[model samples]
Target: MVTRILSENEQDLRLAGEIIAAGGLVAFPTETVYGLGANALDPDAVRKIYEAKGRPSDNPTIVHIADESALKQLTWRVTPDMQRLARKYWPGPLTMVVPRRDTVPNVTTGNLDTVGVRMPDHVTARALIQAAGCPIAAPSANLSGKPSPTTVEHVIDDMDGRIDAIIRSTPCTIGIESTVIDMTGELPMILRPGFITREDVARTLGKDILVDPTLNEKPEPGVEFRPKAPGMKYKHYAPEADMIIFEGETEAVEAAMDEERAERESLGQKVVVIRYSQEDTETAAHEFFAALREADKDKADIILAAALPQEGIGFSVMNRMLKSAGYNVRKV
Candidate 1:
């Protein structure tokens, strides 16, 4: 199937929407990452997304809405806290998992009772959703378990012929997926970390939030782990090369990376080393996935990445870095 590359104009946006309304797939940019979108109410359309990405059916997709009023149609219960969070962080890089209404297909929710929903803060994304006239269920447009696409080129690299159309727009501002929080509990628990930090959510709700242990540690061997959200129970955002993360003081980590680079070079192996200041988590978040993709483009044999301190947005950046490295962290 030939995929149509659409511009971010009114005419092309309408065409993209028509494709979605007709139970077809389209990849469009969000502030965070490009999403493979299908009508949330159409199970068959939603299934196409899983097929295109080779994503596991059991992993859920986030529903993107154009306005706040649409939230009530998708979710059964919207608590006072949910409203407050919507008021504060709805049009940003944050996803709240809430009870799903019967209208939302079980396939979209990954056979779970809840669904993740968010209102993206991008004009093109919102315009496309508005034109489609239904909530859109979308996950990152990249192939499953690979780096999320932040540019139209990255989306084309993975999904050009696999999907119907791709809305070419500016590169994503935040180069990672949105923060996913389960709002079913007494306090919101973060299932996936993104540009939105735990502190930001806690401050918005005036209470402390919980972080899933799996974010920082892998599940035990031989245990069946069902993820509550995306990026929880998968080897996501990984490059083609062997990757290792070094965690410790800046000087020690840099020295260790240098030694590893030299040793690998002596063995006639190509190596790529990623280094960033512990305090610059925003830049780290914006560039982490793209860096992994670049390493793959260079055909590096091994990738050595500097581990950031797990605090604030740094904690969120580490989540993706650790996963891309497959949790191979060495502390000096």
Candidate 2:
């Protein structure tokens, strides 16, 4: 398929929306990450998203809405807790999983009775959804297990020919997937962490929050586990090169990187080093995926990265990093 690159103009946006309305895939930007989208109400359209990304059906897609009123059509019931979260974090990087209405296809919800939904803050994302006249079920616009695309170029890298069209726009601001919270239970549980920290949600609803245990570490060596949301059951946000992480005091980690770089250079191996200061957690969050893509662009044989402090948004960054490296870490 010849994939067309659509610019962020009225005509282009309309064209992208028309493709979506017609049950074709369109990759567009959101505040969190670029998402490859299809009409959420169309199961066949939603299937194309999985085929395009080679994503497993068990890993569900998040439904993107243009407005809060659209939630009623997708979910069975919207409780007061759901309303508080929507008011606080909608039009931003937060996904709420609630009981799905019969209208929401089992395929879109990964055969579960619940669906994850969110309203993106990006103007073009909202415009495309409104023009399409339907809620869009989308996942990060990258090949399954590869780094999530944050820029139009990155989207083109993994999805240009695979998808119907791409809406070229500004780089994603949050540069990661949204925080996913499950609202089906009385005590809200966070299935994934992102820029919206635990404190942010707790403070908003004035109640304690429960976090999914799988987010911090993998399940037992031989335990059976199934993830309820995307990015949980799969090895995601990885790059082409083999990535290894060095964790320790800042000075020691940097010194180990220097030594490794020298050794690899002597062996005529291309090396990419990604290290960020402890205070640069926000910057790390923004550039982590892009840096992985850069390493791939350089055709690096190996990638060596310094671990982010697992506090604040760094937890999200570390989560992606560990997965990208396949949990290959050495404490220096």
Candidate 3:
């Protein structure tokens, strides 16, 4: 199938929406990453997204809405805290998982009664949703388990023949997936980290939030945990090369990465080293996935990445690094 590359204009957005309304797939930009979208209410359309990305059916997708009013269609009830969060973080890089209404297909929720929902800040995304006249269920528009696409070129590399169309736009500003928060419990639990830090959420709600213990730890072997949200039970954000992360003080980590690079190069192996400065955690988060894509493009044999400090948004950046390297790490 030939995939149409559409411009980020009113005419093309309407066309993209029509494709989605007709049960076809459309990849469009969001503040975080490009999302392969389909009508959330259409079970068959949602299935197409899984098939296009080769994503596991058990992993849920986030429903994107144009406004808060769309929540009634995707979720059963909206709590006071949910309202508070929506007021503060809507049209931003944050996802809230809540009880799903019957109208929302089980396929979209990974057979769970809860669905993840977010209002993306991108104007093209909102316009597409409005034109489609339905909530859109979307995951990052990349092949399953690969680095999520932040630019249209990245989306085309993975989804060209596999999807119906793509909105060719600028690179994503956040350059990672949205922070996923489960609102079902007494205390909100962060299943995935992103630009929206836990501190930001807590400050907005005037209550403490919990981080998923597994967010920083390797998954237990031989255990099957059905995820309530994306990135919970999946091996995601990986590159093609064998990758390892070095964690410690900045100097130590850099020295270790340099040593590894020289040793590998001496052995006639191509190596890629990725280490951001101490003060550029936001830049680190923005460029991490793109750098991984570059490594794959260069066909490096091994990738050595310096670990980020685990505080604030740095924690989120580190979380992606760990998953991309499959929890392979060496502390100096």
Candidate 4:
């Protein structure tokens, strides 16, 4: 299958949309990450996404819309609080999971009764969706269990020949997935963390938001747990090399990394170190996945990362770091 690399011009955007309208795959950029998109209303089209990325069928995908009014067609109900959240964060890095209408295919929602939806804050992404003329069910464009693509090159690295086309654009501004919140419960619960923090959502709705325990605690060994959203039940955003995170005070973590670097280097191992202050989460979030990809590019034998404080956006960055390290964190 030949994959066409399309520019961000009007003609190419229309071409990308036509591919989607024909039940074909198109990888396009969003503010958060590049997403492999298919028409949400078409089950066969949605299945192509899973096959291209080798993603598990049970892992749900998020539906991207061009306008707020489109939500009426996809969701069964839209509450007052849902409207409040949409008003505040719809065109940003936030996804709300709500009850799915019959029109949404079971394959798209991973057989769950609810579906995740978002309105991206990128012109190219919105334009492509508008051209497609239907809600797009998309997940991160990269192959499953690898780092999510933030740049067109990253998308090409994973999906070049596997998908139909890629809408070339600027690197993603926010280098992580959106914050996924389940709106079906009594209180809105965060299933995945992203640039949008819990405080931001809490402030928007004027109430406390529940953070899912699984966000901090991995499921027990040999446990059968079904994820409510993407990045919940899988080892996602991982690099090829083994990774370990050092968690503690900055000085202690740095010292531990230095010692580990020396020890590994003595054994003729190539080590990569990633260090960030707790307050510098914005930079961390923007560069984390790319750094992981670079480490793999360098053929690093081991990757060492410094831990960030588990609060605010720092908590969100740590979530990805912990997963990339396969929860192999050491308290220094």
Question: CA lDDT of 245 in candidate 3?
Answer: 92
The predictions' CA RMSDs to the true structure, in order, are 0.8, 1.2, 0.7, 0.7
Model 1 stretches with alpha carbons more than 4 Å out: none
Model 4 TM-score, all chains together: 0.99
Per-prediction TM-score, please?
0.99, 0.97, 0.99, 0.99
lDDT, candidate 4, 1-332, per-residue tens = 89999999999999999999999999999999999999999999999999999999999999999999999999879999999999999799999999999989999999999999999999999999999999999999999999999999999999988999998999999999999999999999999998999999999898999999878665678988778899999889999999999988888888999999999999999999998867889999999999999998999999999988899889999999988999998998
lDDT of candidate 1 at residue 226, scale 0 to 100: 66
Clashing pairs in 3: none
- Stretches off by above 4 angstroms in model 3 are none
Looking at candidate 2, the ten consecutive residues that score lowest on lDDT are 218-227
Look at candidate 4 and tell me the lDDT of residue 82: 92
Candidate 2, 201-248: lDDT as tens digits: 999999999988777585456775556789988888888899889999
The predicted structure with the larger lDDT, 1 or 3, is: 3
Q: Provide the lDDT at 199 for model 1.
A: 90
TM-score of predicted model 3? Answer: 0.99
lDDT of 1 at 155: 94
Worst 10 residues of 4 by lDDT: 216-225
